[model samples]
Target: MAHTSPAAAPGAFVAASDVAALAAGAAVFGTGGGGAVHTSQVVAEQALQEHGPVPLVTVDDLGPDDLVMLMSGIGAPTVGIEMLSSRHQIDLLVREAQIAAGRPITTLMAAEIGGSNGVGPVGWAARLGLKLLDADGMGRAFPSAAMVSMNVAELPCDFAILSDVVGNVSVIKTIDLHWLERHARALTVASGSICLGAHYPMTAETARGAVVEGTVSAAIRVGHALLSAADPVQAVAAELNGAILLTGKITDLDRRTEDGFARGSVTIAGTGADRGRLQRLELQNENLVVLEDGEVLVSVPDNVTIIDAETGQAISTEMLRYGQRVAVLAWACDPIWRTPRGLELAGPAAFGYDLDYVPFKEINR
Candidate 1:
């Protein structure tokens, strides 16, 4: 296991091999929705070559007064394949955020954990020399930015700066976090359904309180595990202390692309220890729920990941299909999300389900 020393400065060189490991880590943290890692790694590699190495910074290393901003690509990942982004688009978003906040963004953070989203921030961080926080808004990837723990913590979601590759830039100020999601999603759809934006301005105090710490390091660990382990599923399970929810061949998948979202469910016929059993997964861009024998085993906030059982690589919801053999992994959410208010904000009930939030530990036990 590779570990950075505590005495190391916030901004230190990250080698190319480590970047590959970090990308794998991002995939596990992505919880099956941070877009693809290949794209992010390419961008990060380009930035590294042009601007030299990028640094990883912990939230504690930031000054209380420093303006830290979060940046991410928001849209349908399927659409992103066709609409590639330019570096200028990212710069536009960051610059606009600085202008809106009236202070230069001294640091950067990923809005979510996923292969691409996690690695994407590295490009911006390398280009701008902004310290990349070893933390993120969502420990696992979710479809909407507002689904982050930061939003659940009542952090301000307004004042997002958005930009398209075509040079269109706008600052969105909304009355509420939901409104921010609604407005941003609409704007993103109109702007070719793939826009880069920066939001969630926070002092170091707020960051310490809400952000999932050590996520960048987690992503790196996950990536390394995936690359080094003979069985990647076991590697991920060890890294997350997660349970292998189910392993079987996908027998059916009900899917529909609607309202700019991919909504669906997958049914898998059990094998091995799970033989004679059935597993099902519900998804909305991100995997939201998992069921075994008709009982809810995992719900939102807690991660539900589907991976190719044979390869041990994650399978995105959009790529889910019948006849694919998959292994389901369930990991616990951040401790804060187990609270009443956190449940009310993002639990299964909030997603229109009748069941209450059940921590993965309890279910696994």
Candidate 2:
């Protein structure tokens, strides 16, 4: 993930047209995870068009006494795309979470910065007249709910509200975030593979300390750079201080359902100076590992993203197709991700790989 100084207290607005740009930037931060936003973008654009602009507020805008809830989608992006949830689902989760707390919510924030979850709540903010905090729990998308930095900060995620497309709503009060993830995944599969949720209501003070600051604006600006720059791929690398890790065309893609999640791998036959060599990428809902000739190039925590070499569009793990040309990229995560606890919570080992976390700089060098 990329970082900049904290963004100023919010009061900005996202025009309906520019929401797509935010979605683009969010995909970059997704690091080949967070599910894709193709459907979410179309749906969000329509909502924004009907409702006008959505207001944005930074964590700094909130007082210590404010109440905030985390908003996100639970399920495979592919499934969520096919099984569209109701727009009213977000509002329902928010209301239910608040109802469980017996307090009204002052603002809504994303639990993770991602393709859909990062900017998804703007739709709700517009219709509900609630403040939308700009930061998120995970700077980039992580596979599990407990991977959020808020959990690292020891914030309790209780009274989660989940709803399916067919109007099945479940209000779960869990003392453990892992339980929240497990039960939520089960519910999501039962709901035909996508559920909208709101959880981890926290004080503004806790949110201020826990979230990855300036991520929303960062996504917006990255989106703008991609639109304006001649080489969108290079533009992203430059803007985020990332490295072009590899360039190639996908030769084969292997995907399957594992433990109720999408897990797979892909092989990219290198092109240009890298011709005759092959690169392999492992997946678990997100890009997990990058290997060239059996040597690790990049791994989880630090981003490992695949972008269309020509159009610069991101290809999510579930969307990788054979014969599509692409470029691989990597960059350092926020400083927090390098911490011992952060690694323990979200590092390579956290993803079930028998590898220690390597900083982007070291791995790339």
Candidate 3:
């Protein structure tokens, strides 16, 4: 098992020991999505153990001329859990992306700082001897590729490079994020619902203010808190400054993999002091909303995580099992996600839900 070390200075440096904590913390932000983290943890640990620690640099640390790429896996969490990805797959994708980038890729960043995507890039950076950016496109995971900070910031995606485990690769050039989502999903579905890719190539100058900053370090902090605390569940919530929305056992789950996403709803019957109450979670890959009696209690653009009540580990949508006791936690997302354009790109409306995003602070306070 990988062990975590003390927090690093300036910015976090992810070593082999940090993989376990990173995966655990990343899962919390995953919000029951972002593809499961177990396999990602293993791969990351292996890479770090072999290649030494990767320096996690902040956006400000980057030179204006430096090139950065977003490294991530695209597919349903259900499929990802079954089909383990190899370093060779990531190598192919990054190599192809580099060729398309037309310049040396100085840094690699997570497209989303949730689940496996958050952890995968650490290994990719280590293996490639590149720096890992401490920022990400999404502070939490979203099902669609278009729901990224760059899109909300109106930054253009020059191209996206994708590759499957079997060596098939494709480079898509499109300024439209939605079109990228559509085409990438098609290729991912064709490649057995899982593939590795790099996209959103931009100069450090362009990325400095366009991405969700410090998410990688935040994940490490949450993971470290979870590992050290006696009451991990409460500790994690406290660390994130989040609230426990519900504590219950999964009574029913309706889930399916379609169009490269795990779409579903889960019903939980509240236990303990909250007994006799029922809540439903509607999800498209990531937990989208929490509802009770048809009333929206919590919705997207805010972080909603369903975690194992006893262990504090987030239970991704694909891993939800009937009768498992869990706790639902809610926290405010980055302030950027609350802005008009951010909401337009990732709000309840973006996910096809008709509801206003209530700020977590307002709701909690």
Among the numbered candidates, top TM-score falls to 3
Write the residue-wise lDDT of candidate 3 on 1-365 in tens digits: 00112223675588999889899999998998898899889888998999999998877778867899998899988999888876488878878888998888889999998999999999889999999988889988988889998888889899999898888999998759999999999999999999988999978678867888878888999999988899999999899888998999999999999999999899999999889999999989999999898788888889899998998899999999999999998988887788898899889999888788898788666
Q: Tens digits of per-residue lDDT for model 2 on 200-284? A: 8878666767778778778888888877788999998888899887789999898876555778889899899878889898888
Q: In order, how many clashes per candidate?
A: 4, 1, 0
Could you give candidate 1's per-residue lDDT for residues 134-168 as a string of tens digits?
77877778777667778767777648888887999
Q: Candidate 2: what lDDT? A: 0.79
What lDDT does the true structure give each of the candidates? 0.78, 0.79, 0.88
lDDT of model 1, residue 278: 92
Q: Where does model 1 exceed 4 Å of error?
A: 1-13
Which candidate number would show the highest lDDT if scored against the true structure?
3
For each candidate in turn, the TM-score is: 0.93, 0.95, 0.96
lDDT of 1 at 150: 80
Query: Candidate 2: which pairs clash?
Result: 10-58
Show where candidate 3 strays beyond 4 Å. Answer: 1-8
Instruction: Give candidate 2's total backbone clashes.
Output: 1
